[model samples]
Every structure is written in structure tokens, then in C-alpha cells.
Target: MNRKTLVLPAVIGLLAPVLAACGGSDDGGRAGGAITVGTTDSYTASKEAPAPLDPAYAYDAGSWNLLRQTLQTLMTMPRGGGEPVPEAAKECGFTDSGNERYECTLRDGLKFASGDAITATDVKYSIDRVLGIKASTGVSGLLSTVDTIETQGYKKVIFHLRTPDATFPYKLATPVAGIVHPEEYPRDKLRTGFKVDGSGPYTLRAEVKGDTIAKAVFTKNDRYTGQLTPKNNSIELRPFADADAMGAALDKGDIDLMTRTMTPAQVEKLSSATTGDVKLTATPGLEIRYLGFNTEAPVVRDKAVRQAMAQIIDRGQLASTVYGEMAEPLFSLVPANITGHSNAFFNKYGAPSADKARQILSKAGVTTPVRLTLNYTTDHYGSGTKKEFEVLKTQLDRSGLFKVEIKGTKWTDFRADGLDGKYAVYGLGWFPDFPDADNFLAPFLDEGNFLALPYVNSAIRDDLIPQSRREADRLIASDSIEEIQNIVADDVPVLPLWQGKQYVAARDDIQGVEWALDSSSNLQLWELSRGVSG
Candidate 1:
């Protein structure tokens, strides 16, 4: 089920001498003057933490959103909502009885940002590039069902799927499908520093890396002329080593914009600071928190064992203790806003009960404590993560029926460890690709999907996903997604924790800060520029 909305929180300026002391920009609305943003998003430019301008590897939230906006997909939701908006392709239709042969008719007179006329060859080359780098990129898996991608005229491209996929167009509208200049981009790395060439509104102009790089300034993309909501000529994306240091930098007028590692405590502190020039936006929607149990492990394979363990989690108390009132109990993998999601799990599980858990364990012939290891990313999910896990460990240990060992790993390494089938228990947070049941269903259900968890459920993997993909109706798609989720809740291989709250800080001068489906919340720079500049 596909759903979309455009809403960004706005606050009036909190201007004072204190705010001026910290920075020039007010914390209220944005006016598009000089803006310095700060965020604690650290990424290394190496093979392990490789820097990829290519959209296919746009896995990280920060990079994905920018690349998504900078590059144009063959089709897009102009409002960033539902279905394809036909940015590149004017008309799209389906052929073949199984709905596998999808054809598209494109709009002519389009050119790459580099001034090269777009052609069917360019389309082929762009897609073929991702298909080529399937191994290193991790993008190959997202497109595994594709049999072939063909082009008819300079404007039209047809995708032949091994199986029927109705939601393929939605996928096409995603950043992963971002079309790049075929002439410049070859099999591997992007050519130069932020020098992007695409048929989008914005064109990459200048990108200064660090104080180490030649230039240390950010500027507007020259090629951007497409109808956009662009408010600022240039938006600066700066990474801070830590949130505290970044917070200090923002106070000292060192940065203009910020994201990543933003928490409630930080927002509360920064927003209410005597220097309250920075606007803090309260973003809403599916920022999900959950505990993923490796079902493949022999210890978790037993349903009684897993269910008993889930029963021991004090979700309500835990939510209050770790997340405070900012979070809610997640009963289903799909959030309430997502189509077809109901509190079905809540109806089934209810509040945590230790007596029932002990009963289940006793029935399973488990007399002693169930020893388990819980894993999480130390630096990725902000400072509150380890504390949150500590609460969970305490709750589980309080049951007196289980022994828990908590393990923390860095973000990049934690994923590799999961892929190696190393951890039996781990904490995972999901920021959706799109606001739909499909995003919830596919990620958690598909065995070949994320974490490479072998969630081999034929009904979900083979039937449900294919069924929802072909059925274009959102309600129908939601029904399929809901049925699949019921299976997930019953399986209890993973336990729901809490859904997160999105926060963004803008100056009173700024406006039009739209939240993207993937939780890549940035100022919709176009819709918001200088608002009544003083």
C-alpha cells in the first residue's frame, strides 16, 4: 500500500540577545539568510564505509535524501506522494498477461545536466550500470526480480520482470532509481566532487569537502531549473564528530543546517537555550524501534522460547523509561498510518506478564535461564540507544527466567556481523523507504531482504509480495500487507519496541520543510528559501 503526505512543523522566531550571542539566525522560522546547520553524521570514505554518490547504494538516510532530490528517476511523484509522477516518462502502461512486461512512453526534449541529449541508450546505460555493480553495491538484490530492461525510443523504457510487480513504478520513483549521466558515470565510483549530472531541477555546482579540501564553502547547483519548491540557493550538509560539539558549533555560528543524531533531549536543550535562535521541528510518522531476534539461531527457533521472551518485555514501562512519552508501543510491524495496520499484536500480547512467561518457559521444558546476546549499534542511533537496551535487559532479567548479554557494535560493523550470522539477538530501527505497508512487509518478510534474515515464508515471500505488487489498488495492497504482518506478529522472531519522533530545527525565517518517506528529514530547500528577509 502506497501513501504520501507533505507536512513540516514550523515555529516563530525566538530572537534575543542570547540567540545573537550563540548565532545570528533565529530558532524560529527560516528567512533564508546565512544558515549554518550542524549534525552528528560521520561517514568514512573507504571501502567499508565507502562514499557512494550513486543512488543504488543510497542506504544511509542523509546521503539517500540528497541524492534522491538531486537526481531524477524515470518517473516520480511530483508532490512526493503516491504513484509515479512521470518526470522523465510521460506515459506508462502494462503489457503481457502476468503483468510482467511494463512499458513506458517518455517525454522528448530532455537533456542531462551535462547538456547531453537523453536517449534510450542513456536509460539503458544508467540502469545497466546498477545491474553491473550488483555485487559490490548491494543494489543488485533490490532488483533481483528483473529479467531485463529494454528501451524503445529515446523516451521510452520497458522493464520485464521475472514475476508480476505492480509496485515497480513506485520503486522507479525512489532514489535508488535515480538516473545519472550515463556518459560520465561508468561501472564504479562517481566521477568527481559532487559534480552530478542529471535531468533534475538542481545541478551540482561546487562541493568543498573538509578544511582539507581546496574550497570550504557550499553553493547552489547551477543546472537546477525544474519546477521546485527551492528556497535557498545553497544548502550546506556538515558532519560533526559528536552532537555536543556540533551543538556548540551551532551555538557559535559555525554551521547552518543539521541532521542525524538529533534527539529529544538535544532538541529541548537547543530549542530552549537562552540562545534560542535555532528552530526545532517536531516531525511525525514511522520512525520505528524494534528488537530483532535471529530466528535462524537454534535458541530462538522454538516458538515457545521466543514467545516467552517477548512476553517478558515491559513495553509500556520500557517505553516510558527509555523513550519517555515521546514513543508509543509498536504492536505491529506496520505503523498505524500505514494502510491495513491495526493493533492486532496489541490485542494478542497485551501488557507484559511474567507469570505467563514463566509458564510458557516451563511448558517448553526450559527449567534454567535462557542465555542470549543482544546487539546494537553504539554510535549510530544516538546516545539514548544503549540506555534503552539497558532498560530492556533489566526488564528481561527481572523476569528471573532469562539471562541477557548486551553487545554493542559500530553501525557499519554491526551490519556485517548480522550478515555473518554472528548475533542471536539485536536491536534494529527502521526508517521506511516509503510510507506504505509494502515497505513494512517487504523489509521484514522477504528472506532475501535486509539483514539477510532467512525469513523463508512462501506465503509472504512468494505469494504476498507478488500479489501486492501486481494489485495496484492501495486498499487491496494493504490487505495483502496486513495478512503478511499477521504472520510476522505470530512468528515473533522480532519484537516491536517503540516508534520514534522526527525532529528538525529551522530558523523563523525559513519555511516549507517537507518530510520525505524515507525519514530523510531536511528543509525542503526549494519550498523554503528566504521568507520575508529582513
Candidate 2:
């Protein structure tokens, strides 16, 4: 998942001094009208996300935010967050002691929004199509352990894995494993256009504008069979070009709630008593941002150079100056909230010191005034990014040991360029697929990592990751997870920056704001509804 961006304080003038009254009408203890939700995140049909609505191709958080509303997975995490629970399935678990075989039985009378009965055959086809298509940006890597899928009957589906994987159930809980209709979705290609056919709580009807989505309309799919029930009759998801516009819409009652990409200034303003009609809800967030190095690039390829740069970076300053209270300095690949988290970077490098960095570079026989270019996305991670990068440049340039040049590009091109090794160092963010340390470490460190960097360590990719996956109890794998962190700190392939907190700004009458986001920070639109104020 990509990190969301924030707007500057200059845009704060666009918001009304006080938000208007709630827009939806209350009915039978629930919201009777449609709740309009606004977000600044936009999507384009690029290689990163070829088809936003298709379960086989959508991978990023913005796409999955909408997909989760319509595509019901075999298993799903609970509202407040926990282990995977049955959704479309009546029950699911490992059938063998080795954790290689898994089975699931569909809930009786399960039917898609199209009124066709959901069965084991559809489930098998869905998994097969995702693996067969193998889109570069898709989440096919999550299902790499699956050797084959077999359907025993109309209700039962069995999976055989090539290796022991205790985290298989968690993978199934992700939208990547969402079941698709066999006839509607081809087995070897992505479904075209914006239409979606699934058994989830909502049915989607999107309005497309050129390469981006203008708005998406979701109606309660009464035919849906699942663990969740809709709290509102309908929902309208409005995508904005930036956070300033979205905040203005919320203040003017153009949208009932604003989520996903609120700027830091907007959030601070909403917390004041002057904005009486707006409510600011803060939740524990697992999102993290970091700088990734292209190990093959001439300037950053030297281990000493990367280590010296890591020593000079002040994560605390970045967290406080750039993000305010919204983020905290992170020392490990794993966030502090997750199990097996360790302060490996701090333990190795201590506090940021130009003296320490100079000594390391001198010992490595490297000359002073080293030059390098830093790349970041201009439009993807909010407008505060420019300021953040500017602060970073000052931090490095003031050391007098390095000369830094920074460049910003749009997200689509930045991602593509990063993949093609056109950048020496680039900024990236991660939103977990599941709430596990494995999701944090394995994606970037494993062989053929998603970042497309040439860095590799046999000890981490070959030994530690597989050992952790063999244990069903994630707690038992803490030692291996910590060791992985230690190796990363020593290698410096990716430098840890700061971890973020999830904040949602909504109208005072909006209910379920606390339960609307799962552990992974994916928005659940079905959980939102208009409520009567006390």
C-alpha cells in the first residue's frame, strides 16, 4: 500500500469555519439516505494497477478500499481487528498437521449479487485466475505457496500447498483471495471496465472520467450472503484531486464524511472547538514510510555509503517537524505495535550524528562531498512531501559530507521508474496486507522483492522467512522476526523513517467511525451510517 499525502496550510482557507449539520436522514435507528464519503486518493489504469475493480488485478489500498465493499473473500478480519473469521465460508482451517493442506465449506445458500449461487467451483476459479494472470503489480506473490486447488463438491474446496505455511488463512482473508464469478471473470485475463460481480455487502456502480474515477455509487446488495450487514441504504464515494478540495466539501456538507487522505493541517483544525459539528477520530495505525536504496546504483551500492547515510538521518526530526503528532520515529522494518518489533537501527547507529557518519565514510576510504539524487512522488503522498524532502535535504547537506539533489515525480511514473532502477534512492510507504510481522519484512527483503531492488541476503531470504512461516503461532516466531530486523539494520538496503497514525475526520453524527477501518487500515464503507446525536 502507498502512503497518503497531506496538503499545505495555505489550502486551509478553503474550509468553512464550521461544518454544517449532518446531511443524511435517520431511519429506523439507521441512516435512511446515502452517505457521501470523500477521499483525495486517485487511481489510474497503469501497470501498477491495470484494473481497479477486478479482484485479479487491484493491489493498492485505494483499489482494495473499494473492492472490499463488493468482493467477499473466503475469510475476513473482524470489525475492530483479529484473526480471520468465516464470511462466505461456513468454516475453514488446516486439515493437515504440516499446514500444507487447507479446506473450506461454503455457507449454505450463498449467492452473488447477480443471483447466481456461489459454490466451491467459483472459489477455485477465482484463485486459479489470479495465479494464471500473474499481473506484475497484483498480489499473486501472496499465494505463491499454493500448489493446486481442488473442489470436492458444490460446497467444499481444498487447497494443497507446496510448502508448510501457517499464514495461509491470513492470505485468504485479503481481497486478493476474493471469489469471482467464473463466467464474468476470465481464467487467464483481467476483467475489463469498472463493473464488479461478487457476494459482498455492497454493489458498485462507478462513474469514470478519462483515466481516473470521479465517483463510485454503492447500493446495499440485499442478495448478498455474508457476515456483515449494511448500516446505510447506499454510499457515494467521491474522489478529489487533493485534500483541500475534500476538506472544503466536508465543511459545506457536499460530503457527509472525509477519510483516507486528510492533510495534517486540516486534521489539527478539525480538532478545535470552533469546528463543533466535526469529529476527529484517531486510531492505532500500522502504516510506515521509509527510504529504499537501489543497491546497484553506483553512489548507493557501497555498503559503507548506505550505512553512513543511515547514520546521518534523524528520524525523530522527520517525525516531529514534518508529520507533527501524526507519526513517530521508526527504527525497525516492523512497526512498534507488531509483535517481534526491535529497535535494531537505534541499537546499531545510536542517535543521528554527522561526526559518526564522517568517521564511517573516512574509514571506508570514501571522499567527502559525495553527491546523490533523492527521488520522491510529487502527487501521491500529499503536498507535505515537498517540505519533508526539503527537510531531508537540509539534514544531509548541513553535514558537509554529502551533496544531495532531490527530484519529485507523479506516483505512477515514480513507481515505474523505481522498478526500472532509474533512481538511486527513493521514498516508499507500506500498508500491511495483514497484521503480521511477516507481511512487513518478507515483502521487501525476500528474493524478488516487490521493490525491484537488487539487494539480497541469503540468511534472510533463504532461512529466516521460511522458518517464521512454519510456525502457526506468530508469537513463537518472534526470535526469527527480530533477527530479520537485525540483518536489515546491518545491510541498510532500506532505511526506516517513521510510522504513521490513522486519522479519520467525519461529521459528529457519523456512527461506527472507530470500527470502519480494519487492522491493515483498509476502509470498510459498510460500517458507516448516520446516527442521531444524543
lDDT of each: 0.63, 0.82
Query: What's model 2's TM-score?
Result: 0.92
lDDT of 1 by residue, 13-88 (tens): 1111111112233222234444445556544343444444566455555555556557767766544344455666
Stretches > 4 Å off in candidate 2: 1-32, 47-49
TM-score on alpha carbons, each prediction: 0.84, 0.92
RMSD in angstroms, all models? 6.3, 5.8
Can you write out model 2's per-residue Cα lDDT over 325-346, one digit (the tens) per residue? 8889999989987878999999
For model 1, give the 10-residue run with minimal summed lDDT: 11-20
Query: What would you estimate as the lDDT of candidate 2?
Result: 0.82
- Highest lDDT against the true fold, candidate: 2
Question: Candidate 1 versus the native: TM-score?
Answer: 0.84
Give the range of the ten consecutive residues with the poorest summed lDDT in model 2.
8-17
- Model 1 error, position 104 (Å): 3.2
